[model samples]
Target: MTLGREDQPGAQGSSIQDGERDSPSAAIPRLETGIPRLDYILKGGFLRNGTYAVMGPPGSGKTILGNQLCFERVRRSSSARCVYVTLLVESHAKMIRHLSGMKWFDTGMIPDRIYYISGYTALRDQGLSGLIDLLRRTLRERRGTEVLVIDGLESVEQRAPDVLAFREFVHEIQGLSALSDCTTFLLSSTGERSHSENTLVDGVIELTDQLIGLRAVRELTVHKFRGGDYLRGKHEVEIQSSGMVIHPRTEIQFDTPQASATEDRKRMSFGIASFDAMIEGGLLSGSATALLGAPGIGKTLLGLSFLVEGAKQGEEGIYFGFYEPPPRLCEKARKVGIDLDTYIQEGTIRLLWQPPLEHMLDSLAEQLLELLRHRPKPRRRLFIDGIEGFRAASVYLDRLPRFLSAFTNQLRMLDVTTLVSEELDLFTPLIKMPSPELGNVVENVVLLRYVELRSQIHRLISIMKMRESHYDRSIREFFIGEQGIEVADSFRSAEQILSGQARLLAGLQDREGES
Candidate 1:
């Protein structure tokens, strides 16, 4: 969701005058972390001079995030400096070596714009007070330091003589942060938290990596942002060589502008003239359509035809397929007499491929949104070849409905006419929906199935639902050949086409017997 600067008050870090306390001009001064998505989640960026806590279990990416912020700060501002103090016994050299692999790491900033110091020995030998003294001295000497990151808060907690001492240490750092106008990040690998520690920090961010049925998913949550209305939820985070990439969940404002009358009146062809006729002259321009079918029922071919038609009509589209790579998809399309490779080469179609396993739903949404942002008005059509891919990617199956709803809403906001293919279980006699949630979010449903008749299996297509429009209800026979999909004539003599076992109608049988 896009929140204008006015929707949120300036961060608490900004000093307020008595007369201008409620003035709109008193916006919070922000310190950009250089992580675009994270900044967006924070309602711009972190509050300048704020003391925030980054809490997580070991290897949950606290260190990587802190280092990334530091490197980005120094890279952006030549005068900006950061002090990275570690209370763990890990040597500075080892830490630097680990960071050197990250894209944000800058060796030239070391000992100058970014200072790495170890407080492990002092904290171990002299306790919390010694660590506090070290920080005080560093802040005093480095007056220009704009940021301070303590990489090991747990070390001080372990060495503290008592809870009071640990609380005192946290308080001292918070005071120092306020006095020096330096944004501070305290990284702790502790699962346990103290009330005083939470109370003293201006904000708290929690990172987690947990196994969800053999796959580990990493997430970040904003536990508290004292003076900011940060996006609230568990945001997906991926740690790559470039550093942390946070994808806030898709949140579409309810007040988003409705589609223009012209946009609503427009209809998009599925590249098949007969199919368009069934759907009352094609799908509504910005609507989401679901193509449901069993395996080998030509769902993929239909989706490909739709995309190819859009491309042929001079419309840009995205093919987000989970099963096949681009080259394989192109080869398959060519066999049907459609050259997907040509459209791909001409930049009319952007193909995105994702493997079936260990995929994040939010990541896919973010990728689609990014593509739309770059392509803008001309990019109108989107074909997601596998709906089951999202279902498999979801850790919580129950949230699938909500996620799909929000995702489709976002697509609608971008004015994309989306078609999604869902694979139903094969050999089932009944026509089962791939997802019950589809009934709510999808504006139209197209059903494809194999119907057994007279010892032969024939493919049939029907329009199940068309919201706000008239559509042909007849179940038509279709075939896939070198010329692609062809729909012709309804099964006039058949009954129960949806049951996967079509039987001749009694009237047709009687007439045939008389003949």
Candidate 2:
């Protein structure tokens, strides 16, 4: 029998053993994550004594996230000492008060193990020597210190006198972390600022806020992590009274190994009997469906229909109107035979006005979180009107996709069937196409148009795409009425149904025969 090069009979086993030792699985180590969902993202946790950078915009919870990690070490008793060095505005007592509000400060035991020292002195003095002296004293005590959190590295930059000193100070701090044998978390508020700290750290986490209209949807991106394999992409996260919580996104793939054969367990009906029948017994629960149309169409009315159905089913519903205020929408729904008063009075429906567009993404996500927190039974339906209202309100367009993905996934996880409406009358047909950000996330899309026949414009409804379901391609004639929406037969002509013109196919055939 012929043997390969590595498998020769005389070859020593040491070389073959070395190949197995270098495999990917062998490199993985079990780690303890200081933060809750953070461990899940770290593929266990950070390596011991590694430096990590946490960055975000102002009021984006960077300080709170760092505090949670510092307190976590205290709880585990892995460290007899944990230090928090802050240079931002708040004093030590005020900072402790805020951390206490999160319930992170249990009054019982181990409070003494946690320490907070003001870094303003070193920052104001503009000397690395003062900072080094403070660090040496803290580290020399040797009380089994395990974690150290440094907040507002930018403050040091302000007083370092020059860029060279600032860079040098950061380098020394990295060296200090290694000498102390404690994992250090450095916080920075980085937007347009130029800082080399991102390169100096062992790991870097960049926080981004995407504005949908006026909403700042916060996301975390792990830019670099040495000696670890982590998820790449912007991830949704929220800061609550409980501290930092990660809203992870699950990309449902049928081709993957764990795809379940059974569909989701929950199901809910859209209120319209005819429409529900058209959709084969209404939309599945925890899935997303988009209703697209020009203004004056029944998109909002359809959203209310689902809410009414949810109310009847004893399930909760939230109606967020971006274009229409709640009072006006409720009044209109009343005229259309959907007495929202009944649902509101019964605590079955929640009507919320569109939040400021500057933080539209954040507001929408926070609304869902609020509902989940207050209503533990789970919401059955969510109706978002004027999703495109955010376009005019958004400062950045690229951020919309990540925001929508986060919002849709949250709804799906809650087992809520979401109905989203997009207003199409504002732009011309060519420019008004659904941006790719929204086109791919939703499961079903329904298009409503104003079609002209015989010189009279009539409303039409067409199923654009229905994921995993069969839908009729023909556009059905529809109307807004006192009894809500009504669907009619499809237009029989073929010249141009949606445009302001159409010619009868039968009439054209007859004319050709005569010619």
Candidate 3:
């Protein structure tokens, strides 16, 4: 039932090549994959009648994604026929069943014009002559098709009489694509070697895994797209019972608005007044802040406070913890009166326990991608209990900086006002450790430490850094309470406390109970 609008070939090329681009109406419509964020990457969609390849390992969702693309075109053009040719897998029935379950698919819109062919193995076994003959017939039969999907091209390569023969066969398919002027997709599972099939294809979408939590987390990246610009990053995706879900990439844009330094009271309480005051207010509603200190210095406690306070304000929150056990962390929050249990039960908060640092395999990019995918609220806050916990837990420390940069960019874009806690080296006098990637990425930094004065240990709070405000530099004594962190009245100490040294004020009483 395609509307039968054949795109004038010379016209599409001339308009684009003639050095003067015409409006979209004069050009052939780009092929769209129904996935919203995905469509954005494909640059107005795939070029009409272009050859595209999806290369990945087995179970990377190449075939499933291909099927989804076909359905997307069929749904959009209505008249454009979709022809799917299968080789290594039997996906037709499963694809149809899966699409049928989606709310977008109507009972009567069974895509009457759609067609498919299976048993490509026999054709491959027939050798070069057999493949050419089958290709000829398929072309003749599906000439009117606007879109074509060839699944498991690797199967053809495996059965070809020889390596050279397989390579030649791949070349022929590329030629066929140009002559037909029909958008096409080839599915391939590539190995470590240079893939002859990939070289022959006009575009390639690669899927791979990042070892995380003792399991491989799936990711996708577009290596090349001849006629379009795509987001250049390995994005996290998942194959659930419903179908393939793609998590779009997030990169920080310099144009993104910065938080105002104004003295506005839009502060988001972290349920700790002292911590909030050091930050010039609590965390901003749409700003990112870091609680940077050494291990066991209460970084996670600060993260929990942000979550607890945000939840109290009726805003949702998510804790992506890379270290602590879920139950243990939740219990700790409960003891502090943060009441995370109710938040979980009420669906206002989500606690995603990441694999222990050692078993975590996914890149920071992938982890961030997953968090956004399952985020519970549209306008929620995010808390990463400790970044160093993730670093200490990772087996591959070399990639840490890269992961952090990519992750920070994503968090800022999501506008979730992240609370990224990190553990630093306790022996160092510095309030915060410098992250090569997170350079100036943090909006504010709150430092917590144990300062000793006259044989008594006191918890000190310092406003190490605030990007947009003139925060008080005075170090203050603080106490952790059942209701959360409380700032004790200002430090009226006899000595300077920040450098681990102090001098008694001449008039200040050092005697017992002298204020």
lDDT of 3 by residue, 1-515 (tens): 11112222111110011112232433555766654345545545677767777888887778667766665566667566776777865666665665565434443434355666764655756766676667657777767677777777777877777888887877777677677667778887774336766666667788775566565677778787775555576665665533455554333111233343223326677767665666666666556777776666677877877887788888888888877888998888777677889888997788887766333333344555545755534446888876766566444466566556555555554556788876666645444465544446677777777655676656667777777576788887766668766776577764656666765676765433321
**Candidate 1, 360: how far from true, in Å?**
1.1
Pick by lDDT: which candidate is best? 1
Q: lDDT of each prediction vs. the true structure?
A: 0.78, 0.65, 0.63
TM-score per candidate, chains pooled: 0.90, 0.65, 0.69
Error (Å) of candidate 2 at residue 65 is 5.6
What would the C-alpha RMSD of candidate 1 be, to one decimal place?
6.6
Worst 10 residues of 2 by lDDT: 1-10
Per-residue CA lDDT of candidate 1, range 1-515, in tens?
A: 00011111112111111122132323888888865477766766788989999999988899988988887787767678889999887888887787777666667676877888888988888778788889989989999899999998888877887888888898899899988889999999976544457778999899998887888988988888887666687888888766787777664212233444234457788777788888877888888999998888898889888888888999888899899988888888899888788899998988999977688777777777767866687448999998888888777788788888877876787789999999887777777786989778999999887766676677778999989799999988787888899887556756766666667776563112210
Query: Candidate 1, which segments miss by more than 4 Å at Cα?
Result: 1-26, 193-195, 251-264, 506-515
For model 1, what is the error of residue 446's alpha carbon versus the real structure, in angstroms, after optimal superposition? 0.3
TM-score of 3: 0.69
